[model samples]
Target: MTDVVATTPGLFPLPDWAKEDLSDLKGHQKGDLVSGGEGGEIARAYDRVRNEVVDDQTDAGLDRFVEGQARWDDMLAHPLTVHENVETGGIVRYYDNNNFYRDPRVTGELTFSGDVAAELEAASGLLGSDADDRLQAVLPGPYTLADLASDEYYGDEAEFLAAVSEFLAGEVEAFPAHATLFLLEPSFVTNAPDDDLDERASEAIDAVAGATDADVVVHTYWEAFAEKPYAHLMDADVDALGFDFVAADREANLECINEYGTKGDVALGLVDGQNTLVEEPGTIAERVNWVREQVPGQEFDTTYVSYNTEPFYLPTSKHVEKLSAIAEAARLAATEGVEA
Candidate 1:
């Protein structure tokens, strides 16, 4: 029997209390807070928010918990934009969404300074002994980072990609042993690279995955990959590849799985993260069974039922409801068996 786990791909809508705390701290610049000029109040606020996020996930009965990247103001560009070597440029629209992130302009060599690892350590501290069994670390994949960045130093696309990959690998190496590592690579579907560059991209992903013992999942959202890109993605040495079942091309995504078959475990983005409508447990379970039936003879060791992407688009209350729904749906799917 396949085990269905309830989890998310990271980033959550900030709670109201957290928003208030952060708003008050906004008067003081982040640099001053980071440099300990403001008594580290900003850090303390983030810590409290992370703790609340963990508690909420635990109460919802999720099998895994993310650090709830509450401090990431710019989503995918946070790590690079904060680095001294990279300059923050004009705001660019994030994918096709209304959200915008300041473009990271690479002015010097990309280097890892434990940006994400520090967040992971703080999150692990919250879970205590159970952290090793439950904590999941989330970060932007090298390809997405490189794609979003404006390279002024490397001058070459492949070199820039390699450097970014190496930088991320360093962060992964520094991470404490955890349950999962979610590499969010939305660009793979929204703006996929040329076929000739597919091998290099997969190699970049493999390099990051090889650095950690955690179960590595390359998650893509916004849309599903076409046949060739999906095939190239399967070539990567990751434990699982996540697909957006809520996207318009979901049927094509299922077809890709049927055609190529998965290498190991599979993460089904059954919950629509962008929408506020809560799906019933029975509906979600039926979708899980549908996926299983669509791809016969292909056995998945574990099926992770999660949001198609982060639910940062929703309000905190709705986000909480969605989290509960995910856990309940996973339970129903496992209890009823795939045939049901």
Candidate 2:
């Protein structure tokens, strides 16, 4: 039987405790938050918030869990956004949502100066004993990360992309062998790059993901594929490919994917993360069956069940419900059994 798994793509909304003042948090130094001191009380406070999310994910009974990215102050760019050489300017739209992120300008040779490895390490430690063995980690995809920022250091686009890719590769290599990594590239559905950039993007993905022994998933959202056939994604080197089936025109996307086919496991974005309405397991199961019907003779060893995107837009309670919905949907679908 194919293991229909449910997992989060990380970057959950900042929870209530995150909004609370951390400087006066008992057990750590106030300056710790600023300097990102690993052993201080502020670090403890950060851990407390992340653990809370981990605990919640475990409670949801998900097959795979995410760190809930509470410390990512600047959303996707995150630690990179806080880097010394990168200057932040006016607020720019974050994908297609109402949410906005400050534009980051790379003023110097981009380096892996961020503490993402530390964040990943800390999250893994917290989830190790408490949660399921399958702990999934999400990162901003290289091409998307480069596209999100303004390049001033590398005069050439290919060079800039390669630098960002290498920086991300270091982070991927540092991840614990047991964890699965999700490369979040929502921009793929929008800014479809030309052949040269597209080929570079694929190679860059391979550079980072190939360095690790862990399972790598290339996840894209914000509606379906654009007018372009998006052969770039088809050529990506990954163990799994994710698509947004909730907010997306599912019929069209599924048809296109069926025509093109995929080399990796198909991760369906089943649970609606944006809406407050919790989707029923039975309804989601039907959708899962619908997908199976769309593509015949396709052997996807591991079918990942997930939300269309991050649940940052929704309230924490609803987000928890959405996570539960993912697991429940997969459970129902699996119980029904997929007929070959």
Candidate 3:
């Protein structure tokens, strides 16, 4: 029973209480820094969004993700922009303006940097020891980072991707000692061929698996798992994989479940985190049962319900708390009919 595992939806939007403008900390500190004020505004935005989704109980869908996209654009344009500073009595500071992906000017290291580490720690604190409970850190995989940052960061994408892979390996090695599971997300892999993507991803995955002693799960979302390049991810790491049950094309999902049913640990993103519709617990339980029936034996491991995608940050604190409750309930329901 103890070995039974689960995870909440990835990337919930930052709550209003957690949101911050981050425009002020533009050029003050050097290392890692936490800011207030505008930062608080950013958190507040997410909180509000979370609240609405939970209360409205409608199918909010991916449109919710668009709000954050606006903020992301600005951040991408000026990756160095800062808001308020908290380390120095709320003074403003600026990031190196470096992209998390492979930025030549910015070293393509995957280990937790300053600001990123602080964010993880805070999220971990919120989840407490449960951070390791079906824990999955949705960090951008090195390969995807390189793909996104290539041209912008390096002249050669392949060389840059390799560098990113090495860095990602470092990050995974660090996770097992700290968190329960390492969910390396390569959202961009869906864009290219599996052969083109697999070698780099495998290098990083193997490095992370070898480096750490804990269970490792690799995931991808925001795109269909079977379409284009994603079908290849199913065969990648054999142990842990997350899929978007709701957003993934239904036909493709059936094929995916059938293909991966016998080998890997599959995570089902049944709940609508991206939408406003608050799914009923019974509906979620039914889906879990369907999966169990599809693959009768211990072909793999248990199926877990997660948000189809991360929740947007416009919801309120109350909304996030509700989501946490939904996650717990879904876990309980999932375990009832299956052998843990």
Candidate 4:
């Protein structure tokens, strides 16, 4: 029985230990935030926030732990955008949410400076033996990052996408082979139709995901599977495919899964990540069971029962409750599956 792992997207509500200055820091862009230096007050606050969320997720029995990414004020565009030659541009909407990311203009060659892995290394070090194989790190997928950025140096879109993939692969190569990495690919589902775009995107995604020696889970959220170019996701080489059922039509998502079939594991975003309506574990378990009913006789190697999107939209208390409920639902599902 695969355990329902409590994993979330990078962005999350700062814990109580984080102060108002940190809250103010949230409104600033990545370039502006980085000007304060890595040893300043905001960095310390982010450290506190990371510790709190890590402790919270671990205490709640979450199977995988993220660094909480409290420092990612620019959302997924950050850390990468702040590198050597990339210039930060105007604020733009990040998916179907109020959140935004500074448009990154690739003025020069993009290179991974090993910062992404280093960001998680501290948090990973804090994890005991229990979380050795369970500590997860997050990276914006190549296609999504390319979609979010402007190619100033590499004018050719194809070459730019390949560059982004190689840049991301550098980070993937740096991560410990035992760690799990989540590649967020919201652009895959929301972008307009392009015949070659889907295939190129899938190839770039597969290349970046394949760079890592450990398990990689590619997640697409904020849209239905049928409405998007995600049908090609089956061809993307990754260990798991995660769908946001709360944002998509649940029936449509299941149909897509049944039609194409998963190449590896399945991650069901069964719990709501955009609201304050605290759902219970029993309720989530019932939803999991209902999803299972939709896809019969298919053994999902590792079903990740987690949030449908970023949980930062929910209130602090509600987010905590939602995290616990997700793990409980996974536990209940595993027990029931075993009994059956």
Per-residue C-alpha lDDT of model 4 across residues 1-340, encoded as one tens digit per residue = 6545656765677665564665565454343334355436566666677788888887778888888777676777775677887988888887778878788898998876776776677687778665558788888888888888888999998899899999998877887534578898777776732676777888898998888776788887887665345667678779888888887777777778787777557777878888888788877777777777788867776778888887866777888888888878778877754332
lDDT of each: 0.86, 0.76, 0.45, 0.76
Residue range 190-255, candidate 1, lDDT tens digits: 888787667778889989998989998998888887778777778788999888888748787888
In model 4, how large is the Cα lDDT of residue 52? 85
- Winner on TM-score (1 vs 2): 1
Span of 10 residues, lowest total lDDT, candidate 4: 26-35
On a 0 to 100 scale, what is the lDDT of residue 303 in model 4?
A: 78
Better of 2 and 3 by TM-score: 2
Each prediction's TM-score versus the true structure: 0.96, 0.90, 0.65, 0.91
- The per-candidate count of clashes, in order, stands at 0, 1, 55, 0
lDDT of 3 by residue, 1-340 (tens): 3222334534444444323433344442322232465445555443354344333322221111111222332222112222121111222211222213113233333333333334344444443454453234444455445444423334565565666556555655444224334343535435543666555655655554554555555555555554434444444553666666676665565565565443446666676655565666566767666656665544555444566555543254444543554555455554655332
Candidate 4 local accuracy as lDDT? 0.76
Provide C-alpha RMSD values for all models, in order: 1.6, 3.2, 8.7, 2.8
Candidate closest to the true structure, highest TM-score: 1
Per-residue C-alpha lDDT of model 2 across residues 1-340, encoded as one tens digit per residue:
6778888788887677666756346554222455434445566667788888878878888888787777675678774576767888778988778888888888886666646666767777876674336778788888888889988888889999898888888766766644578888887666866766877877878787876777888888877875343566677678887888888787768766777777658788877777889887778878887888778757788888888888888888888887777788888878745342
Candidate achieving the largest lDDT: 1
